[model samples]
Target: MTTDAGQYDDQGEVPLAGYAALASVLATGVGAYALVARSRGVRLPERLPPWDVVLLGVATYKTSRLLTRDKVTSFVRAPFTRRTGHGEANEVLDEPRGTGVRRAVGDLLCCPFCTSAWAATALMCSYTASPRLTRMVCGGLGAVTVADWLQYAWTWTQRTAGQ
Candidate 1:
């Protein structure tokens, strides 16, 4: 286990300081956006179509990184072969409540945002890696972008319809 923190462990290497900085910048941007939205009276809601997912995803992903870094990552017994941890070994694992809706929104935001960022870098290797991999990533991104568009369209339609 190697840590950018200058150590090695069985858990492998911790992410570089670059990931930490990137996460921090993302967190700040999301927080600032939320604050600005609130100031404008654009009340951010917590639900299926919540724009808040951007912030939550950033924070949650960051938290996951921190938790994993601490080497306190927990594991549970698997079913089929009595194996533990994630993957097909634990097919019956339950997603925490709110995770679905939250991740739905995350999928609707995070992927697209990330896709753009990685594509912009050109070195992220996610965009032009392989046709199949690129398609999967872009497809996932399109899902979120489409959902976001549809959400805005629906809201606009409702407002115009006096809803």
Candidate 2:
């Protein structure tokens, strides 16, 4: 339903799925906070890299792709989605099971944009808790992120060059 702000809002009885998503986000935040606290206690490096935000953004992008998409999630989305096809791109099947916590988690898992937030939180907290390992992982993912963009750009160039 549309709210007074002219934005989308839930109508009728609020779905538990929405509640589940909200709770999950809050819980994640609390967990991140705890990690930060522990990092401080352990005298870990709290300062971020020079381009840490940008790095995390790239890492989140790669992580989202790993979580969502077809072939990637096919191996992991069981009990939530039916696994079908022969590991092809469009083989992963999503089975919507009405409104509930499971549905909420399924939705979150199916959308990279949604999952990116969770990934970013985890990466950010990890950076504080263990900068060395976090940087290694994020750096590698960031490299892949750049490679992905370059591949897209290359394809676009090839197509446009023909014109």
User: Per-prediction TM-score, please?
Assistant: 0.28, 0.69
**Predictions in order: lDDT:** 0.39, 0.70
Which residue segments of model 1 deviate by more than 4 Å? 1-119, 122-124
Q: Give the range of the ten consecutive residues with the poorest summed lDDT in model 2.
A: 84-93
The numbered model that scores best in lDDT is: 2
With a 3 Å backbone cut-off (N, CA, C), the pairs that clash in candidate 2 are none
| Candidate 2 Cα RMSD (Å) | 5.1
Query: Candidate 1 on 1-163: residue-level lDDT in tens?
Result: 3455545445543333434555576568666756765676654223322332343344344333322222223231111112123432112222211233333323223233443442333312222233346445445555654565687798789889995
**Each candidate's clash count:** 3, 0
Q: Supply candidate 1's per-residue lDDT for 130.
A: 38
Over 1-163, each residue of candidate 2 has an lDDT whose tens digit, in order, gives 3565533355533346565776777697867788768766955465655787788888998898877765746657665554434422233445434466666666766667878988887887777677779889989999977887788799889989999
